[model samples]
Target chain A: MIQVGVNGYGTIGKRVADAVAAQPDMVLRGVAKRSPNHEAESAVKREYDLYAADPDRTDEFEAVGLPPAGTLSDLLADVDVVVDCCPAGVGAQNRDIYDAHDVRVVFQGGEDATVADASFTARTAFETARDADAVRVVSCNSTGLARLLAPVAESFGVETARVTLIRRGGDPAQTDRGPINDIVPDPVGLPSHHGPDVNTVLPGVDVDTAALKAPVTAMHTHSVNVTLETTPTADEVRRLLADESRLFLIPEGAGIDGAGALKEYAMDLGRPRGDLWENCLWGESVHVSGRDLYLFQNVHQEADVVPENVDAIRAMATDTAAAESMATTDQALGVGLESRLDTDTELPDSITADD
Target chain B: MIQVGVNGYGTIGKRVADAVAAQPDMVLRGVAKRSPNHEAESAVKREYDLYAADPDRTDEFEAVGLPPAGTLSDLLADVDVVVDCCPAGVGAQNRDIYDAHDVRVVFQGGEDATVADASFTARTAFETARDADAVRVVSCNSTGLARLLAPVAESFGVETARVTLIRRGGDPAQTDRGPINDIVPDPVGLPSHHGPDVNTVLPGVDVDTAALKAPVTAMHTHSVNVTLETTPTADEVRRLLADESRLFLIPEGAGIDGAGALKEYAMDLGRPRGDLWENCLWGESVHVSGRDLYLFQNVHQEADVVPENVDAIRAMATDTAAAESMATTDQALGVGLESRLDTDTELPDSITADD
Candidate 1:
């Protein structure tokens, strides 16, 4: 079994550690954190070996009744692969250490593309990172876009894709982040960084993106429109998207109108941390007019990338094929089987050119 | 002077009555209310005539120590123009009463376009309603779109316009409305009714729109993208939008990033009811890439349509030219003069084709 160490036990780090632990092919070696806090205590309670990320904070860890299993260097030396969940720029800072240890590394999306040999999402570019030393999983928005566009480009041939990302202001625990009572054009720039980020995995796909932040903490909603080279009925497009394991086509009869109801549904199903690992696309929103296709999808910022990180680690350390690796990760983590609604609820007839 | 009666004295009604009272060329005949409440008492305190909209509820008004001047019919017969500010669909119900009285009527955007003889926004199609029996002022979002596009279409010539409206869940006083912690694909349909609404005034302009609802109560923010017939530098477009009296180009240094800050700025300026009567477009957001133009603008739902109603009144009752009537309305109600910051703060050099 491949041993994995998670660096930085924060929002994403803790979740990635839990995901790695669940994977049957891998074992979670430990998690590294700079300070001793509630998360550290919880990590210890869950029987995870907690390493001190900062050598200077080792004493503080023991003083807080959470003794360190080892230093970050010791953990790095022991593990076969490390998932660097350090905050955005810090991953680049940790690169030299990872290189010296000569271990495979998986970087989260927050790091710049240059920090990794390849940018990856399992469905789109898993082979690009096959047996590579390090790979970066693109951000939630980019992952959602790449996962969506890959199939569209393959089937209908995308000519131009334009999207407006209506982003949540913060995750539930980010109390200080804001626009609490407002909507703001985040970056207020044309073709925000998300478009170029999507190109990292799926090159030659022409996509333009704009983003705004609203007073919400649930999930990011994307309003997507794509001009295709060939026309397809909305029903055909819906069937195509439904084939993807990561895309959850929300049904109308479920009455899951928005993120709140979606979360409530997930909690009602007793999902761990009420996580939704799939892209929740409103099934009824799938529409086609001539060459134009439009729909909206919700990306859970906290959880969408967790599965990608798991698949990325496998791509770097194993010779497993992309589809097989993805299937293994999906089954091990219960990635796509969350729907309890009657998805067979009749949708309106496809909007087509004849209409 | 044109005598104006306001029916449905709720959020928009009270504001319109005050605006009419402020206009030198108009008189507030009275306001109509269905039942007695604090608003009725406040109207009485302001010494304005109050009419009971529901004849059966006249006793309810008298029971609360608020006496009605007469029924809604009396107010409708006395005024030269009546502004219908009832809730959505209620305006359609009130249409027969105004028609029976043979009075000129200005209906709010809530009513269907078929309810009026002409759809109106002062800047775009003022003359469409010149001396007409009735006209409808478009909604706040449409008014903002028209006001921004009129100058743009005049200067650059719009080929196609696409907008994604990030709508506030409800006005501040609307406690019953929600998606309180979620973002919803309101309608989840392509080319929402907003595109058609804009066509009601600025016909022949190709526009497609989509909208979402966020957990905000401050204002609606729009992500606007237009393909212009000719390319222009971002600076030129910024200057063009800045010249429009009703467009408040927010400067970068002023630190107004979103609706919350914009509303706070207005309240700090002591604007009545913290109303932003202008479209708050972030000047720095004005961007041009080849033939495509992009920007973001905020529309105050409670206030943007107020000035339109005032101008629609003149459009339906008098022969004033569009420019003169808009100027008069602007001057009397202080429409365009709210900046306290040094708008002269130099912006970054334009992002142009050559850049």
Candidate 2:
């Protein structure tokens, strides 16, 4: 079994631990936490050997009424791979921990290119991190735009893409978000730079993206306008999109509504906790009139990237073969998380098996 | 010369007055205001002989250092058409006003059906209002959806159109609009009554719409998921859309961004005011992949519907020749109101000329 240890027991980290533990090929060695906060205490109560990062906490382990788990050093001792679910901008510090432990690390989006020494986007940036010890899953927006644009770019030869991304100002933990009742312009700058940022992952694509923060937290819905060098029929295009496994095309007869409906659908499907692995795509909303086509897609930031991280982790741990990495990643991250969050149930067998 | 009088000088009304006055064939007879507030007095300085709706201020017409433009009744005396820019459910009162003066009246969407005898929409709703002296402009969402859906329904037999309307919480004026930062489901229940309401205009087509109010006042964007009975090529559908004068297809080659770019293009084109007569459609964004197609469109509520109101007015006025009336209506409305709000420069003769 591939021993996996998760450093950081926050929302994403905890979910990662549960996901890793659910896999047949994987065994969760332990989970590390900061100090004994309410959340950390809860993790400890749930039988996760929560390790405090502070060395001082190791000396006080007995004095504090907590479990007999050791420090970060102890958690890193026997792990093949580590999923660093630390806060944004803290990946640099975590990188050192991974380097010191000589373990492969899956870093979140908050870290810079220097932190991972590898970029892990499916399309543009995937090959860049091919040999690097660390891999980074992009932000939710980049992943979403990249997925949609990749197929179009390859098949149709994209001329220019003008997209208006209606992003939710609040993350799951953020309480205060928005000018509440107003739709402000993305940023008052040309190209908004999000498109260029996406190009970092999707090379050779000329994309100009503008982002507007709306009063939402669940997902970001993108109003994408793409100009293709070659025209493709809407039907042909939908077929191409449906080919991607991560993309769940909202079929014609399906009565799904917005991102909320999509999230609820995944949750009902007994998906991995948080159900972030699936891309909620609407098929009928994909209208291609002439060389131009329109598509509406909802990208779940926290959840979508989680599975990508799982893939990155597996790739880092085993040559287990790149062709099999994607399938393994989905199996590792996609299934049980949805069920856990929904029914509060433990790991289910269907999800743990690699397809 | 066509004499146009505005009854309520609010956000839309003031723009209408300036629009009418700028036209060579139409003359602004005067405008009706409540009382001589600083804003109203300033309107008088711009030569809109202000009148009062308050009965008590009937005689104060001469006392306010203004012309004897009379009360709301007096304002209607020689006016060929009166445009009611009043609040919701109140524009119905203009029916009596129109009948008394034996002139057609243009009503905004704010007026409920009970308030007005008939509704005026670009998508054949005028057929229902064909007999009335009053014609009502449909709500912004209704108007935008109807215009986009009409051709689609006619060409490919609409199976079902599921639309998620992200509406502005309130107009720029209203203080309290919504659940603030929360994404609240539109409480009115099932397949929003809007689709049914549109069928009133187009009898055979079946459509469904859901509305959610965001906290912004600029423009309302729709996430439209439509499944047609018969599938057509995306290009074919785009060609049909391109044929419509009010529908602008944002082609792919341009470096333009979102609807904002479309708005700027309209402004540069010397439209009557910076109002858009057609839907600022993203042409390249219309994607037809397989049987599924996607499209993104921006509806400028204040701008797009303004000219439609003018069209409905002319259509309602000409009782003898329906075809001629509609033909004139299309041309008049197509003059492109994009120039009106551009810069403080007079519009080009071709755009400002009255039909």
Model 1's chain B TM-score?
A: 0.95
Ten-residue region with minimum lDDT total, candidate 2 chain A: A346-355
Is model 1 an incorrect, acceptable, medium or high docking prediction? incorrect
| Cα RMSD to the true fold for all candidates | 20.3, 27.6
Candidate 2 chain B weakest lDDT stretch, 10 residues? B346-355
Model 2 complex DockQ against the native: 0.01
lDDT of 1 by residue, B1-355 (tens): 9989998876688778889999989999999987564445556766889999989878766665677999999999899999988877787788789989988998888888898889999998999998578898998889989999989999999999999999888765444468677899886978799999999999989999999998676689999999999999999998898889999998654546677557645643436766789999988899999999999999998789899999999888888888998999888888884333433322111110000
| Model 1 interface DockQ | 0.01
Off by over 4 Å in 1: A338-355, B1-355
Model 2: how far is A100 from its true place, Å? 2.2
lDDT of each: 0.81, 0.63
- The TM-score values for the models, in the order shown, are 0.51, 0.47
Q: What interface RMSD does every candidate have?
A: 18.9, 28.7
